[model samples]
Target chain A: MHSLKDRTAIIGVGATPQGKLPGSTQLSLAVDAFKAALDDSGLEKDDIDGLLTFPGTTAPEGPLNYLRVGEALGIDPAFTGSMAMGGGTAGALVQMAAMAVESGHATAVACVFGDAAKTGGSRFNRASGWGDSWGIWGMMGAAANSAVAASRHMALYGTTSEQLAEVAVACRRHASMNPNAVMRDPITIADHQASRFIVEPLHLLDCCLISDGGVCIIVTSAERAKDAKQPRVLISGMGQAYTTRTLEREDWWYVPHQKEALDRAYAMAGLGPQHIDVAQLYDNFTISVLLWLEHAGFCKPGESGPFVEGGRIQLGGELPVNTAGGNLSESYMEGWLHIVEGVRQLRGQGGERQVQGAETCLVTGRGMTLNCSNAMVLTKGEA
Target chain B: MSDHPKPLPEISDETRPFWDGTRNQQLVMQQCARCRHIRYPISRVCPECLEVGHEWVPLSGRGEVYSAIVFHQVYDKAFADDVPYNVSLVQLDEGPRMFSNVVGVPPSQVRVGDRVRVVFDPVTEEVTLPRFTPEDS
Candidate 1:
C-alpha cells in the first residue's frame, strides 16, 4: 500500500467536557467542539473545504454553518462524506481525511460526533429491542453478552475475575488524574468482586458510564502543518472491521478481521503494533478493552487477563491504554474522547499520569456487542 | 411440554436440510464444491472461496465451546420467562462455528473447551434449534 504517512495530519482536536450535560442539547455540544477545533487550529472556518462526519451525528449540517467557521478556515472543500452509524466512524473517518488529502481532493477536513444518550436509555436500549427471535431466546443486553464471553475467557485462560478487576481498577486510577473523567474514585479488586453482578461474571462496576458530550478533529495537508503554530500529529495507521449486527458471533474469542479498519489503516501507514507508545481505547465495558487487546494482537488471543494485571496498562505499564479513563470511567458516546486523549499524548499535554516520552499513540473506537470496530495511530510532530 | 417459543428463521429450498436436520436431531454442515471450504449462514457461495457448488455433511454433533455466555438477565422482556439461559458459538467438528443454545446445563456446567454434543428442542412445528449437551447426555 502506498503510504499516506505525513500526507495529512490532525492539526486540531477538540471536545466538550465529556462527563455530563443534563441541560445541554447534543447539537450544542457538537457546535462547541467544532468552534474549539477551529480556534485551536488558528484557521478561519472559511478555510475548511471538506467536511467528514458521521451520518447519524447530532449536528450534521447545521453546526458547521452555525459556527460560521468556514470563512478563512478554507471552508470550500472538494469532498464531504459521513461514516455509517457508531463509534467506529471516528478512526475510520480519519483515514478518509488522509485519503482526501493524499488524492489532492481536499486540503482540510473535519470529523466529529456527539450525543445526549443519558437523556434517554442510551444506544444499548436502542441496539436491543429488535424483537428478533434473540429476544424470544433470552439474548437481551450487552452486559449479558459480555458476561458470558468474559467467563469463557476466564475459564479457558485462567483469567481470574481479579484480573478483570485490575482492568477496572487501573482505569479508575487514570480517571482520578483526569478531571474530565466521570468516575474518578479508585476501585479495588474487592470492589469489582463485591459489586453486584449486573450479569454473571461482569459486575456493575465493569460497565460504562453514560454522559452527554461532543468531540471533533481538524485534518489538513501535512505540508501546511510545517507553518501551522500548534504541534502536528500525523495519521500513521488505521483499520476497521464489521460483522453481522444481529447474528451471534462465530467466536467470542476471535473477532472477524478481513475488513477491520485497523488492518486497512495499518497497511496504509506501514506501521505495526510495536511502534505505538500510547493508546486510547474505547472501554465501554471491561471486556471491550480485553477482547480488542487480543484482537489487535497486542497480546495472544484469550490472554487479556494477564496482559492487564500488575499495573501493566497503567501509566508505567507496557502500553498505556485508555489514559483518559475510557468509557469505563469516562464518558460513553462514540468514544471520541479516545481521539482527544491520543492528541494530548502526541502534544505532550496529557497531565499527571501521561505516558512519559510518548511520541506515537493508537486509539480504537468500539461499539454494539462487538459489531463496529476501528483503530488509528497518531505520531508526534512530523513522524 | 408447554408451548415452546417461536423458532428462528426457517430454512427454505435454499436452507431446507439446515433446519430439517436439527428437527430430526442430526448435526450437519455445508462444504463449498469449488473450494471445499465449509461455511455457515447457509449462503449459496463460500464466504472464503466464493465457490457456488456445495453439499451438506453430517457429523457426530461433537465440538468444543469456543466461546459463550449464559444470560441470567433476559435480553428482552419477552424472554423474561427464559432467564438464566445460555447463548454461545460452538466450533463444530467441521471448520465452521455454529451459534446455538448450550442446553442440559446451568452456569456451573458450562466452560470453554468443554466436550458437547447436539440435541434438538422443538420450538415450533417448523423450527427446532440445535442445542448442545454434556457428553454424558
Candidate 2:
C-alpha cells in the first residue's frame, strides 16, 4: 500500500464566531468560513477543485450537500462529496481530501462544516432511534448515552467525578487564553462538581456547548502548499476505524477499536505517543478525553483520570491537550476545531496558548454512538 | 384510551416480535440459528455468522446492572415529574445488554453490578414494557 505521509499539506484554516448567532443561516456561515480560508491561503476561489461538506444535526430539513456548496461558491469541483459520520466526519473528510489530492483527482480541496444548532433550536436533548425504544423510561440525549460509559468507567476503574472534572478544568484553562473560545472563564474542579448533573457522572460543565459555528480547512499537494500562503502543515499519517455492534459488544464502553485506529496512525507516522509534542483529543464530553488519552497510549488504560489530574493536560504541562480549548470549552464545531488547532499549533500561530517549539501533533475524533474513531498525525514543514 | 405523554417505541417489522413477546409477558431476543448468538434491536441478519435465519428465543430475564444513570434534567415535559429517575443498562444472563429502568427503589439507590429480574409494565392495551427490579426485592 502507498503511504500518504507528507504528500499533502493543510494550507489554510478558518473559523467563525461561536455561540448563539441567531440570524445567520448554515450556508452563510459556511461561505464566510470558506472566504476566510481562501484569503488566508492566498488562493483564489477558482483554485479550489474539490469540496467536501459535513452538515450539522440541526439542518435535517435542508442539509448542506456538495452540490449546494458548489452552487453557492460558483465553482464546480472535479472531486466532492458530503459526509455524515458524526464528529468523526471532520478528520475523515480531511483524509479523503488528502487522498483526492494525492491521487490526482483534485489539486486543492476544501472541507467545510457549518451549524446553527444553538439558535436553530437544536437542544441536542432528543433520544436517537436506538434510544427511542427505551424513551418511555426517560432514556434520552447524548448525555445519557455517554453517561452510561462514564458510569461504567467509574465503577470499573474507581474513577471519580473529581478526576473527570480535571478534564473540564484543563480545557477551560486553555480556553481562558483563547480570545475566540465561547466559554473563556477559567473554572476549577469545584465548579465542575457544583454544576448540576445533566446525568449522573456528567455535570453540565462536563458537556460541550451547543453552539452556532462554522470551520473550513483547505488541503493541497505539498508542492502546491509551498507556493501558497501560511506555513505548511503536513498530513504525516491518518487512520480510521469503526464498530458495527454497540451495547451488545463485551468491551463496549472500553472501545478497544479506537486504539487500533490510533495504532495504525502511529505506525504510518513512524512515531508513538512519546513523539507527540502536543495533542488535540476530541472532547464532546470530559470522559471522551480520558478515553482518548488511554486509547492513544499517552497513559495506561484506567489511569487517564490520574494522568489528567494535577494539570498534566494543561498548557505548560508534560502534555498539553486541546490547547485551543477543545469542544469542551472551545466553540463546538464538533471535531473540526480540533484539527484547526492542530494546524495552528504546528504553524506556531497558537499565540498565548502555543506549545512552544511544538513539532508533531496528534488530532483524534470519535462520534456516532461512540463507535467511529479517526486519528491524524500532523507535523510542521520546513520553510 | 391512555394519556401517556412520554414517547413510546415505534414497533417496526424488525422489532415486532420482541414487542409481541413483551405484550404476552415474555422477554425475547433474536438468537442466530447457526451461532446461537443473541442480538438486540432485532435485525434480519446475524452479525456473528452472517446467517439470515434467527429465532425469537425467550430470555432468562435475570441480569446485572452494567451501568446506570439518573437524569436530573428533563428532556421531555412528560418526564418532568420523573426528574432524577434511573436508567440502567442491564447485561442479561443470556449475554445481551439493554436499556430499561430499575424500579421499586429510589433512583439514587441503584448501583452497578446489582442483580435484577424483569418485570412487565403494560402501558397500553397493545404495548407492554419490561422493567427490572433488584433481585433482593
Best by lDDT: 2
User: Which candidate number maximizes TM-score?
Assistant: 2
- What candidate 1 gets wrong by more than 4 Å, as runs, is A23-26, A55-77, A123-136, A143-149, A239-252, A256-275, A291-303, A367-373, B1-7, B10-13, B27-29, B55-59
State the lDDT of candidate 2 residue by residue for A211-238, as single tens digits: 8988999999998888667998999988
Question: Per-residue lDDT tens digits of candidate 1, residues A117-164?
Answer: 676335463223232234434555667556656766777678877888
Query: Which tens-of-lDDT digit does each residue in B1-137 have in candidate 2?
Result: 22447788788877888889999889999999999999886777887888999989999899999999999987887888787899999999998988899999999789999999999999877779999999878
lDDT of each: 0.71, 0.89
Candidate 1 docks at the CAPRI level of acceptable
Candidate 2: where are CA atoms >4 Å away?
Answer: A60-64, A129-132, B1-4
Root mean square deviation (Cα) for candidate 1: 4.5
Taking every candidate in turn, the Cα RMSD to the unseen true structure, in Å, is: 4.5, 1.7
